[model samples]
Target chain A: MQEIPRQTEFVEVRGRKVQWTRGGSGPDLIYLHSAGGETEWTSFHNRLAQHFTLHIPAHPGFALSTGLETIRDIQDMAWHYVDLFEQMGWCEVPVVGFSLGGWIALEMAILRPHLIARALLVAPAGVRVPEWPYAELFIDNLDALRRLLFYDPEHPAIPQALPTSLDDPRMLNWLRAREATARVGWNPYLHNPKLPDHLDRIRCPIRILWGREDRLIPPAYAQWLAERLPAAEAVQFESCGHMLPFEQEEAFCQQVTQFCR
Target chain B: MQFFAFHLMPWDRLPDDFEQRYETAWTWIPNSLYEPGHGGTLYNRYLDELVLADRLGFDGVCVNEHHQSAYGLMPSPNLMAAILARQTQNVKIAVVGNALPLYNPPTRVAEEYAMIDTISGGRLIAGLVVGGGPEYYSFTMNPTWARSMFREALDLILRAWTEPGPFEHYGEHWKLKYVNPWPRPIQQPHPPVWIPGAGSKETIEFVAQRRFAYMGIPYFHIDFFKKNFDAFREACERNGYTASPSQLGWLVPIYVAETDEQAWAEYEPHLWYFTRKLLKGLVVLPPGYTSARSAATIHRALGKFLSSAQTRQDIEEGAYAIVGSPQTVRDRLTELAKWLGVGNLLGLFQLATLPADLTRKNMTLFAREVMPQVRASLAESGL
Candidate 1:
């Protein structure tokens, strides 16, 4: 696959300049990033770009985004993205979201079903299950967090992105991302109490992907989510953890591409 | 200097292999481990210590809130304050404090504080705190909203106490139709507000702006306390007010005996237990507990302190605690008080599993032998 030349740009959405990346040319495929903040364009983005024009926006509070002050909850973030779609002139785009972003994608689907033509939620975390609670990302130390997110801690592709120093910019960005996540997903814990009730409202076709070895949110949650949604399928990837995109990059992109097609 | 006898009221009867078995003493520690009969005795004994402190002429008896933890038994400090109000006379019953944000309407805090104040006949120092990071996990609270909720809840509490009731409160975090607290506080305006902080600049500013007494958290090194006190004083100066010594309080763990060697021999094990065992793997700050700037500052400061004090000798040299004979304790405290310029001293005599008799004796000795000398020294220095 030829590498897609990606360019980072700021798009003004509801008085906030949202930083986003764009590349490739085809059907609009909006990418939502996980809680660790937006990653550098990888082989996943490269492959996806060949099929669809990838519109990946750094979630409001991550990196250089300016919407942290305005976004209060996941619902607010859903609405912000809704406005982003309209402002960017994207109509009925296929949305692919990872982890925290997957939760946001679900919210978007519920809020405005028409906006998301198709949805692929990879290891999503927004459903309240009493038996299996989401692993606490906020409380875990950096090393523990990495272990929770990856199937193999020694994987070469797995970024060794621990904070170099207390004042490291990367550290600050990580903290900001976690802060943003807490702002949205703190009460009732990373899940909307009413999400299950409103699952039927999402008319768009949905694919819930989960890593078989996912420790952060159990694979059982994906099954539970698939059961709730009106039009949904749950697929589990073997030998992968919470970070499906990074762990099984080619397979994740292929699954997303197939679902979108 | 004013002295406060503070009790953590810890459940100290952990099995010998507790450190090896449990990851932490807080949050996820099994409830099955808590023996109710033992807990009952511990509570009674702890309360007895506080009452004894009152009888011994300690200025205040402080109780704090911690949930689902062997670290502190008092989940409801206000409840403890209410009991202390009736039992102890003369001593200020300081519920230091109710975690402001944890209360839903926050008027609950207002009503409870007022009730305690009324019962205590105005001898209440209302210590408002943005509960620690571990508390957010234990209470299942959002750390991002902790500061905002604290500010909003504080505003609501103050209004509920001072403003004529039946006033509607429509804030971002809480919406209340009628915040009409029945019993207003006995203190004319309100009780003296003391806020405990772990040297966050924002907290220092917030506390200093209101001229509330800023109580330094006891866990950090003496140098950290000095730096934080200086920062607080600077914050006060920036607010165009010269901070009085009374505006600052230091929470210190102290153990006094007839001889320095005796004090160290007895206190060392308990202090080590409190520091190493009960507090192991407990620095879990819920994301967004502090702003990025504050967190960075804390991390930087903590890194330096932790690096320096990896050994017991380093900890002792840092003066994290004062354990000595009455004269030695008094001299050390006097030096600290003079250097830090803190008028209020919150002494934790009853630490993790320190037996009731020893706690009582330590309190008695400090009050009788050491307290007068410290006070006299401060007075002579015109502090």
Candidate 2:
């Protein structure tokens, strides 16, 4: 099978331009990235794109997206993405979200159930399980943050030096993304108090995936999520930390592909 | 030159191996280290020092807010200000100051500041702050929204003080229906506003625009302070105003004794405890506490100085802490004032583990021996 070339495009909603990537040729599948912000098309994105036309968007205040001032909370982000979907004329699209993105995806499903055909949440955050609370990402230094994100701190998948050089534009983008994440996720500390209560509003099929060795947020949260959602399935991967898609790339893509099918 | 005696009121009773055992002296340091009985004694001693400062003819006695830390005992600086207002006479009781974002209504700050201002006969220098990064973590305040919350709260408070408000305020963070505040401040057009900042361009510009007295934190090198003061001056000029010397203040830890050698011997341990044990890591600036630009500026300016190998001699030489004989202290301070062009000096007389007697002695020596000499030097220099 020949690999499809990814094309970048911008969608404007409420006077703010949202940057998104598109590839493959099938039913639209929107990919929401984790809090660290979206990376360039990785093997996982490429593999996932083979099964569906992937529309991966950099969340507001991340990368090329604008209007950080307007986005106050998770709900605002959910609504923004929903606006983007409506502008794209997308209907009941299957969504795959990771970490912070997973939380946004779940919020989208809850806000407008008819807009989401299915959701694949990988190590999603937002459901507050007091016993297994998420680690304080804002407080951790770079070394501690790296350790918390992966099962192996020395995992090659993790970018050793944030930017290869001082002039790298990605560095500023990454900082902006981190700041945006803090803005949205700081007060509630990455969980919505009312999310668990609204889980029943999500009418679409949901799949929760977790890294068994996740330290940022335990796999127990995945079980809790599954227990709450009316239509949900939960799975865990061994020898993986919070960065499920990167640590267990092949397995993660395969699970996502199967769930999409 | 106006001089303010500032007290951090540190709980000084840390174990001998505090640096070795604890990651930091703030936020997460074990609460068991804090005994209420010891804390009570420390508070009274600190208040007594402030009162003594008032009697000694200092212009202002300052207390600041900090949370979950031995860095400063007063979480409610207004309460301390209230006590000082009643007990002390002929001194400005500055709550330098309340962290606006931490309070829910924020009008609580306006109300309390008003009460203090009224009580002190218009002597409150209302210093508003966006609480430090550790405060955000301890209080669970969103670091990213701190600036916005702070600005909105400041606007609301100013209006409440100046604008005869029963009006409504609808801000992104705070929405108030009736913005009426009782017991309006005695100071006309509200109390003098002071803002402390660590060399952020935005802060300099904001302070300049508002004409608020900018207090520079002595966490960086003397060069950084000079640069910050120059930047503030430039900002004031750009904003079509000449910044008076009184508009700039330097907050520095000062220790004085009869002789230079004696001062170093007495102050070294406490300074070490302060710089090494109390100040550590990203605890001072959690992610998003400052804008990315300011964070980068902070990293560039203060990064090298944060290394653990920074010796007491290095700190003293860098003018982070001024410690010596009365003449030596006077000379350094005069040079600082002349160079920085700041008329106001906020001297931290009491430091980490410096006992009550020594603290009192230090304060007395600085006032009687050093302050007069500094004034004489400034006058002779024709500043």
What lDDT score is found at residue A111 in candidate 2?
A: 77
Local error of candidate 2 at residue A161 (angstroms): 9.7
| Model 1 ranges off by over 4 Å | A1-4, A24-27, A160-168, A227-231, B304-312
Mind giving the per-residue lDDT tens digits that candidate 1 earns over A27-111? Answer: 8899999887865576678889998889889888887887787788888999998898888877788899898899998888877
Model 2: DockQ vs. true structure: 0.56
The top-ranked prediction according to DockQ is 1
TM-score of each: 0.95, 0.95
Q: Which ten-residue region of model 1 chain A has the weakest summed lDDT?
A: A159-168
CA shift of B35, model 1, Å: 1.0
Cα lDDT computed for each candidate against the true fold: 0.85, 0.85
